[model samples]
Target chain A: MARPLTLYYAPFSRASRGLWMLEELDEPYALRLIDIRKGEQKRPEFLAINPAGKVPALRDGDRTVAESAAICAYLADRFPDAKLAPAADAPERAAYLTWLFYAASNIEPAVMARANKWDVSAYQASWGGYESVIDNIAGAVRRGPYLLGPQFTAADVILGSMVRFGVSAKLIPNRPEFTAYIAHLEARPALQRAIKIEAEYVAQLKT
Target chain B: MARPLTLYYAPFSRASRGLWMLEELDEPYALRLIDIRKGEQKRPEFLAINPAGKVPALRDGDRTVAESAAICAYLADRFPDAKLAPAADAPERAAYLTWLFYAASNIEPAVMARANKWDVSAYQASWGGYESVIDNIAGAVRRGPYLLGPQFTAADVILGSMVRFGVSAKLIPNRPEFTAYIAHLEARPALQRAIKIEAEYVAQLKT
Candidate 1:
């Protein structure tokens, strides 16, 4: 048997992206919950898995990968049969990697700056500014049924989760493009399964 | 002959990471300078290449990849003959991709938060905290001649650039590990070439 895949996860956290990715991959995996509310993620044992002490760290037997985008990218590439990512040699792979990094590199930092009211100069910040980041996502999704046209790769899982979370948190303005994009993602059975699984986990935690 | 590779670069900007990556790949790529100080990067023409309007956007034939880490990842994967990254099927690829995403996802944002003195909670921020971020780098580099141990991969280029820039700007503490890591990277002939090319460009701008 292949090494069992395990995801260190916590609901109401960025780990949801990894959870959604797993569901989309339609792969068998074990979810090890880390309770962020109880500071369980910050505990030593958890930190051993991911030095960052964050959830969504995926362990495949001996190897562990952290960072939400990285986990998604790793999983996508690992299970090429899922067709969740373009082949490495494919021409579209350039744009594919770009959007994956863009979600973490640009969107996350820009959102943080905006939410915190940080006065970082647009020129100085690698992300430029919140408006530009949002605008770029809006433009890309508008041009998309997916980020790289018709194929909904792992880039969508990473970027879509960010946009969905941002709009829900009121951190990102609910532009028509974003709303339409989120609505489209909502229609996906994989995402629907992810949402249900997350709700079930959250419900279990409360009781 | 393969299609030409072009680096849309700006001196003293994040584009230097792309330059270093290109040098490391040992590939012939044209450098297209964008003067950020004069706001040439903000021009409509440049924005068409990278919606973020940032430097270090790399174009391979008809494809353009932006974000410094993304550029490095793309180049490393596209030219796998250089062995700058592990193959998709290689077990080492998990840690490799993790470190690539961690550079942008963790290191950059943490540095920005620290520089701005943004009052984001350590737990709330995806990066955890500036201290943790720096500590992780220190711990990783101390365990390495490179991030993934002896084999020098693109992760080194992305993370090393952040740590090196961080130390130079005094944004990151001058820990011995960081200094040593930067020193090791400094010894690279590729990095040396990139630095000389950047200096020449900056000198020309002055003249």
Candidate 2:
């Protein structure tokens, strides 16, 4: 048995992506829910775990990995048995790293900026707003069922969940490429399990 | 000889950091300067290299990798002889990945948000703003000369450049920890070469 891990998660937050990744890894882990609705994530104790006070923070033994994409990348490498990453020196590894950071540094911010209708100038913004962010992803995924093609990696989880949320929340235009890419993710049994588990967790919150 | 690589860089852009990384790797790479002031990044030919129209894009052989942190991480692993990354299965590996993603996903965006004074609600913004981002990095670096301690990695390059830019721009506070961190980074030989090269590139624009 591996060292036990804990994922401090919230159903409605980006933690959903972390939980989805956990399910995809097929590893034994514990989930401790942080109720974002009640402002539980901002509590003192939770802030100690993540000063940013975000959910989807994972603790492996004494080490803590926060930020959703970081957690996903760490888990992929830690559980290399899952083979979600290419070898360190593999040629494919460069694109894998590029897409993961792209999602974190660009896609997430662009979606939020668009979702909130923030006043952002395209040239001034690093992400250049939602249209091009979407365009970049679509241009790549148009070649694939996966961002890396042929093999599903953690990059897929990052891109798939972000696009899924954007489409579902009506923040992103329902383009054919995004629509099909999200549908492909939806069919994954791991994502289905994550959805089911969160439903149970959220239902328990009401009682 | 290793495969020849090209760095599509611009002096005023974040591409300076990418050039820094190439210098750190101590490998020979040709610098193809893209003049952002002339709107070169938005030009048709440049768009073919990075459809997002971002600088700091890299072309290794025929594969293209954009995003500075991603490029740093890729080059670090690609040239493992540089000893910039922890061994794949090392205990330090998770923290290594965590900091790299933190720089891209958290520190970089946090600086931009603070600099632009975006109206970001703390909980809604994944990066939690500049103060918290600085706090997180300070907490880690106060324990070190580098993010992972006693040794420098590509992650330091990312954090170092961002803080240097942030403090110089007066966007990030020049606190004890940050000032000390920037000073430590300035003492690095690789960074010195990057700065010298950038100055030369900039001087050419005036002629």
Candidate 3:
């Protein structure tokens, strides 16, 4: 039997990336929404599940996985039928891992640095300052309509969400490439479904 | 036939983590050490291997994988005989991925922020600031002799390297847990071998 996938997520958090990935895979999952405003994510129970007390954690049967990027990679591998990732030994596997790690290591930090106005020395910082990171990402997008050139892997789920958030947060300028790239992602039915579901869930909070 | 693993590495850099992993795996690989001091890493030929112009890039035949954390995970998966990772179907797999990502996402950035004196609001920072990240890591270490408890998975290779470097750099204080953990890791034959080889390589450069 395929194990059940449970996602402990919340609105307006990085959990949205995992939520979008779940929607993309069209897998059956129980969404245990933890309200950040209500401090549910910090509760003793959630803390037991994730010591970091962060969202987008997955409970695959008895096991739990945290970190949005890791969760995305795990689910894609777990549910190979979704074709979210190339086969483990596929030639493209290397590129897939590269972009996925880059999203967490390079893209996330770069976004945070820009969003928080942190000053990182260009020589020491791995991302080489926000401007360089941004240019690197831009260069990647200019290479294609998708991150892996043609096939949209699970990397797109995280990277796309980041680009979309960057656009909305005004952290990344709406250059033609970024704008066009986001449009392509938004047009996906899975992303649309996830966004709508999240919007409805968020709306319920007010009621 | 299994493909030859070509590792682009440099001693004393994050590439050391990959070298430690290679030792742990006991895999036969061709070591192409890039002299970072000679600016070999930034050369156009090296840039083709990694646009970031960083060391620790692994080439498996035609496939290339970069980023220390990614390389660790890739090797763990590729060499399933090593049993260095939890099976993809195991619940502990999530925990495995979590620590690996956390090393890159939370710990690395937190250490950099402190080392480079990048000032930013902790709440606004994705890592929730260096203090909290360190506290979280210390708390994790308190859970064990290893990141995943008694059994040292590839996550240990990733975290152990960071802990060792952070302590040496004095970015992380040498607390009881930190010191004990480093001592435990350093005692490993694989780690010792890697360090011995790197030490000799560095010594050669001085002559």
Q: Second chain TM-score per prediction?
A: 0.96, 0.95, 0.95
Instruction: In model 1, state the lDDT of residue B105.
Output: 85
Fnat values, candidates in order? 0.89, 0.75, 0.73
**By DockQ, who's the top model here?**
1
- Best model number under TM-score: 1
Better of 1 and 3 by TM-score: 1
lDDT of 3: 0.83
* TM-score for predicted model 2 compared with the true structure: 0.95
Once fitted onto the true fold, the runs of candidate 2 whose alpha carbons sit more than 4 angstroms away are: A1-3, B1-3
Give the residue spans of candidate 1 off by over 4 A. A1-3, B1-3
lDDT, candidate 2, B31-143, per-residue tens: 99888888898898998988878898888887788889888888888888998888776777778887888888887667777766778877877787678788888887887
lDDT of 2 by residue, A1-207 (tens): 545799999887889989999999978899998888888878999988886677889998888888888899889888888988887767788788889989888987888787777777777767886888988899878877888888889999987888898888887778899988887888889999999999999899888
In candidate 2 the C-alpha lDDT for residue B45 amounts to 99
Error of 3 at A193 (Å): 0.7
Clashing pairs in 1: none
DockQ values for all predictions? 0.85, 0.70, 0.70
True contacts kept of 2: 0.75
